[model samples]
Target chain A: MISRLRTALIYVVLGLGALVMVAPFLWMFTTSFRPVAEAFTLPPRWLPGLDSSLESYRRLLASDVPIGRFFWNSTVLATTVTLGYVATTTIAGYAFARLRFPFKNALFALLLVSLMVPIQTTLVPLFLLMRWLGLVDSQWSIIVPGLTGAFAPGMSGVFGIFLMRQFFLTLPKELFEAARVDNAGHFRTFWSIAVPLAGPQIAALSVIIFTMTWNDYFMPLIFLNSVDQMVLPVGIMSIRDPVGNSSATSEVIAAVSLSILPVLLVFLVAQRWIIDSFVRAGVKG
Target chain B: MTSIANDAAAGWFSPQNRKETIAGLLFIAPALIGFAVFVAGPMAATVVLSLMKYDLFSNPSFVGLANFEAMLDDRRLWKVLGNTAFFAVFAVAGNVGLGVVLAVLLNRNMSKTVQYAYRAAYFFPSLVGLIFVAVIWQFLFQRDIGVINYYLGLVGIEPVRWLSSARNALWSVIILDIWKNVGFAMLIATAGLQSISKDYYDAARVDGSSSLRTFWQITLPLLSPTILFLLTMNTIGAFKVFESIVVLTNGGPGDASRSLVMYIYEQGFKSFNMGYASAISLLLLTITVIVTAIQFALSKRWAFYE
Candidate 1:
C-alpha cells in the first residue's frame, strides 16, 4: 500500500512537470484562436471558447509580410543543408569508422577540439568571406556553412563522425572482411556493405540535421538581409515583435504558430526515432 | 580516442594500409575542405583580425593589444559576461536537477504508454525553434495579461516583472532555457539509469537497504559520468544562446540579459567594432575552455567508470 502511494505521487509530479512544459504551446494556440480583445486581457482567458475565430490566421495570410517567400527560402535552405549533411557526414563518418588513414587519430582530435570554440569566433570571418565571395545576401552562404555542420565544423559534423565510428566499431568484423575478400575497393565496400546496413543511423542523422537546419535563426539572420532570402524565424521577427503591443497579439501568435507547424508535424512523426537515437547515443558514452 | 586504439587493434591498419589511406583521404576530402574553410581558416583570420582595426571602410592597421585592453574598460562587456556566466552555472543546474528528478520519477514502475506520453509532453517544445518559444513566451510572460501573473494573483501574490525588470530579466531567460533543455538532459539521464545494472537494485533489496539509500549510494555515483556530460554540454550550449533572449528581451533594461554572443553581434555588426568583437569572442572562448577543463579535472575526483 505504501509503495502504491509512492507510485501515485511520482505520477502526479511527472504530470505537473509535463503541464509546465506544454503550457507555452497551449497558450500559443489557444491565444491565437481567440478574438483580439480577449487575447489581450489583463488576466488571460487561459482557455478559448468554441467560438474562437480563424480571424488571426486570415490576417497573417493577408499581411504584407510575403509569408510564402520566407517559407520557400527556409524550405530550400534547410532541404539543401539537410541533404548535404546526409551525404557529407555519411561518407566522412564511414571513412573514419572503417577506412585506414594517415594522421587519422590526430585529424579526428583536431575536429573534436574545434568543437570547444564558441560560434562567435567564426561569425566575423564568415561574414568577411561571404562579402569577399559576393554572396553576402545569397542563400548559398547559409547552405555552404550549413553543410559544414551549420554552426561549427567542430560540432555537428564531428559529432556525426563520432557516432558512426562508435556504431561501426560494434559491427561483426567478419562482414567487412568478407567484402575485402571479394577484392572490393574501399568505396565499393562502403557502398555495398556499410551503407546498406546503416539505414537506421543515417535516418536518425538526417532527421536530426533537418530539424537543426530548419530551426536555425542566427546564421540566416546574419547572412541574409534580403526579405526574399529570409528564413521563417527571421521572417517572423520582421513580421511582428510580439511584445509590448496588445493590439497585434492574436496575429503575431498566429504567425509564429504557423511558422512552426511543419516542424511540429515532422516531430510528431519522427519523435520516436529521435528519442531512441538520443537514448542510444547516451547509452554508448 | 579508445575507439581509434580499438580500430587499430581490430586490424583496420594492416598490410593494405597504404591503399586504405588513399581511399580514406578521398572520402574525408569534403569534410577537410569544410574544416579548412569554415573553422580553421576563419579561426586563423579571426586571430589576425582581432589585432587589427577595420570598419569595412579602409585598410586594417595593426592595433597591437588595444582591443584586448579595451575589454577591461568596456562596462557593457563586463555586464553581459556576468549575465552569460550566471546563466551558464544556474541554467545548467536547473536543467540537470530537474532532469535527474524526472529520470528518477520515470524509473518508477509505470506503464510504457504513460511513460511515453510523459516524455513526449516534456520533449515537444524542444522540437520547434527557440524563436517560436520566445514568441509564445512573450505573451505568457507579459506583466499584466500573462497567465503566470494571473495564477500568482489568485494566490494573492503580486504580478512579478519577468522580462522587463533588470533584476528578473536574466532569471527569466534562465527559466526559459531550463524549460527548453531539461527534456534533453532527462533523456540522457534516463539512458544512464537504464544502463545501470538491475543487479545493483536486487542486491540492495536483498541487503534490506531502503530505496533512498540505494539511490544515494549506487544510482548517483553511477550517474556521475552522464551528469558530467550534461554539465559540459549545457555550459557550452548556454554560452551559445542568442535568438531566444534576443526575441524575448533584446537584452533589455540595459544589458541585463545580454549574452556574450549577443554582445559580440552588436559590437561587430551594429557598432562596427569588428576587431574588438573578435577579441571579446576569443575571451569568451577562453573562458569556456577553462571552465570545461576544470569540469573534466573535477570529474576525475568523483566520476565512476565501469
Candidate 2:
C-alpha cells in the first residue's frame, strides 16, 4: 500500500513538473492567438477566444521595421554561416584526426583557451576592423566574421573536431592505410571514407551552429547598419519600443511568432539528435 | 616549445613524418587564423584600450593608472558588481538545483517518451532568440495585463508589479532567466547521470540503501564534475545577461537591473567614453576569469571523474 502510494506521488510530481516546464510555451502559443484586449485579461485566459484575430500577423507584416527584409537577411546569413562552419569544421576535423601535423596539440590547446575570452572584450577591436574594411553595415561584416572558426579549432567548432576525432579514433586504422596503399590522396580518402562516417557529428554541429548563428544578436547588432540587414533579434529590438508607447501587443506577438517559428520547426525536426549532441558534448567536456 | 623542436627533429629523422607536420599545420590554419584575428587579437586590444583614454575623435591618450584608479572609486561599480553577484548566485543555484532534480526524475529509467517530451518542451525557450524569449516573457510578466498578475488575481492575490517595479524586477528577470536555461542545465545533468554505470545504482539497491540516500551518496558525487562545469558556464551566462534584461526591463525602474555588462554598454556605446567603458569591461573580464578559475579549482575537491 505504501509503495503504491509512493508511485502515485511520483507521478503527481512528474506531472506537475511537466506542467510548469511546458506552461510558458503553451501560454506563448495561446497568447499569440489572443486579442489585444484579452491578452492580459484577468484569470489569465488560458485559451484564446474564437475572435482572437490574425490582425497581429497583419500588423507585424505591415510594420515599417522591414520585418520581411530582416527575416530574409537572417535566414541567408544563418544558412551561409552554418554551411561555412560545417564545411570548414568537417575538413579540418578530418585532417586533425587522420592527417599528420606540426604543433597540432599546441594549436588545439590555443583554440581551447580562445573559448575563455569574453565576447565583450573583442567587440571594440572587431568593430574597428570592420569599419576599416569598409564593411560596416554591409552583410559581409557579420558573415565574414561568422565564418572564422575560433580557438579549439575543432572543439569550438562546437568541438566538431573532438567529436569527429573521438569517433575517428575509435574507427579501424586499417581503412585509412588501405586507402593510402591504393594511392588515394588524403582528400580522396576523406571524401569517400571519413566523410561518410561523419554524418551524425556533422548533423549535430550543423544544428548547433545554425541555432547559435540564427539566435545571435551581438554581432548583427554591432555590424549590420541598416534596417534592411538586421537579423531577427536585432530586428525585433527595432520593432519593440520598450516604452510600450508604440507597437501594439498584436504586432509584438506577431513578430515573436514570426521569429520563433522557423527555428521551432528546425528543433522539432531534429529534436532527438540535438538533445543527444548536447548530452554528448557535456559528458565529453 | 620543446615539443615543437622534438617534432621537427623527429620529422627530419623520419621521411614519413615529413608530411605529418605539414598536414597538421594545414588542418589547423583556418581555425588558428580565425581565432587569432577575431578573438585573441581583439582581446589583446581590449587590455591595451583599458589603459588609454580615448574617444573616437582623438588619439587614445595614455592614462594607465587613472582609468584603473577611477574603477576603484566608482561606487556604482560596486552596486553593479553586487547585483551581478546576486544574479549569478541565485540564478546558478536555482537553475542547477532545479536541473539536478528534474534530471534525477527523468533518468533513463523513466519512460522514454515522457523524458523526450519533457526535454523538448523545456528546451523550447532556449532554441528561440533571446529577444523573442524576453518578449514572450514580457507579456507574461505584464503589470496590468500580464499573464502572471492576471493569474495571481484569480487566486485572490494582489497583482504583483513584476518587471515594472524595481523591488521585484531583478528577481523577476532571474526567474525568467532560470526558466529559459534550467532545461539546458538539466540536459547537461541528464548526460552526466547517464554516464554513471547502472551497476552503481544496482549495487546500491542490493545493499538496501534508500533511493534518496544512494542519490545523495553516489549520484551527487558522480555528477559533481558536470555540476561544476554547469556552474561555471551558467555563472558566465548569467553575468552576460544583457539583451534579455534590455528587452524586458531596460535595466529598469531605476538602475535596479543594470548589470555590469549593461553598465559597460552604456559607458562605451551610449556615453561613448571608451576609456571608462574599457576600465569597467576590464573589471568585468577580471571577475569572469577569477570566478571561472575558482570553479575549476573547486572541481579538484568535488568533481569525481572516471
Summarize candidate 1's per-residue lDDT along B1-306 as a digit string, tens digits.
242222444454565455687789988888778877877888888899899897877788899999989999999889988888898889999999898878887876778879888988887776678887887777778787777888989999998999999999988888888899899889989999999899989999999998889989989999899899888888888888798789879998888889899999999999888888888878877877987897789788869976
Candidate 1 CAPRI level: medium
lDDT digits (tens) for residues A92-196 of candidate 2? 767767776666667667766755666775666777777888999987876665576552211245366566667666668778877866767667788899888
- Segments in model 2 whose C-alpha atoms lie over 4 Å from true places: A36-39, A151-158, A242-247, B1-15
Q: State the C-alpha lDDT per candidate.
A: 0.81, 0.75
Q: Which candidate is the best by DockQ?
A: 1
- Model 1 lDDT, residue A121, Cα: 73
- Model 2: pairs clashing at backbone N, Cα or C within 3 Å: A100-B20, A101-B20, A101-B24, A102-B21, A111-A151, A111-A152, A112-A152, A155-A159
Residue-level error in angstroms, candidate 2, position B155: 1.8
Under the 3 Å rule for N, CA and C atoms, how many clashes does model 1 have?
0
True-contact fraction per candidate equals 0.75, 0.65
lDDT per residue for candidate 1 within A257-280, as digits (tens), equals 887788777777877778888788
Per prediction, the TM-score for chain B is 0.92, 0.93
What are the per-residue Cα lDDT tens digits for candidate 2 across B6-85? 25556533665665556656666776677788777878888788888888778889987798888889888787788788
